[model samples]
Target: MKELYDTISLQFTLKDFHQQKPNLAFATAEKQQLIALLTYMRDVHRYTHLVFVTAVDWLEENRFQITYMLHNYDIKADFGIRVMLDRDKPVMESIHHLWEQGRVYQRELHEMFGIDFPGSPGVNEPMILEGWQGPPVMRRDFDTAKYSLETYDHRPRDTREPESHMKEKLYPED
Candidate 1:
């Protein structure tokens, strides 16, 4: 970890989440420096496996925090690369070069959080949820319960039955 810190010390800030272990994270000092930082980690540190990518909607800060978790089996260390994007503009370059699975992660985040991966292939395609319309529903700004109430009829919990076929067969209810 210190080796990486020493290399990009000027372009990135190395953060140790805690003192107990060397679990390290690097936050690019500038958005433009993110690709360079990620490339350094992949080529030099051998953190080849991109476990996952996700984003957090920082409503109060009006920004989205994107994190990429990478693992190096040889060194047995996890390296995280983080970038913050403006909530309104929420776009970043794709790290598909480092790991192919990144395409799917980018697509999901783009759908749910409305973050864009500018150069990624198939990133704009629909993923799990489909045929729906609106601003990213997972954004902190989107009120899910409110939207559900407004769009669909609500039923009281007490008035709803379990409706389980197994329960009927096992109990033989009257």
Candidate 2:
């Protein structure tokens, strides 16, 4: 892992790099260099399988972290590439060319996190929250309780003890 890291470090300008486990590591790079870095990893490092693409809403830091998890079957290792995007304008380059499944993840991130992958197919279309007019619910600032209360109809709870309710059901004559 260290040797692989060293090799990558020499080629790309990584902001941060750390090993989570013997076989798993993560590296953060600038958004501008993300596509190139990923390309190099896929081409040179043989990290051919793209396991997943996900995002973290760093509300306090005013940024969004997009992570791409890649796996190398031959080496039995996993590598993650992280890129931080401006919270105000969360945009990232689409990796659909390298991995076709990237489009699905990009579309999901676009809907859930409001991130933009300009060339990602069907990115503008809704994934889960179809025909919805609300803020991105996955964002930290999105008040889920408030949205639920406002958007959904609520009914008062039935205030009854479970034991008594069971007793009533068991002994109906009483």
The model with the greatest TM-score is: 2
* Model 1: lowest-lDDT 10 consecutive positions: 11-20
For each candidate, what is the lDDT?
Answer: 0.78, 0.91
For model 2 the local lDDT of residue 107 reads 91
Instruction: For candidate 1, give the lDDT of residue 137.
Output: 85
| TM-score of structure candidate 2 | 0.90
lDDT of 1: 0.78
C-alpha displacement of 53 in model 1, angstroms? Answer: 0.8
Candidate 1 lDDT over residue span 68-102, tens digit each: 87778897877666778999898888888768888
Residue 3, model 2: Cα distance from true site in angstroms: 1.4
Task: Give per-residue lDDT, candidate 1, residue 108.
Answer: 95
**Candidate 1 Cα misplacement greater than 4 A, ranges:** 10-20, 24-29, 157-174
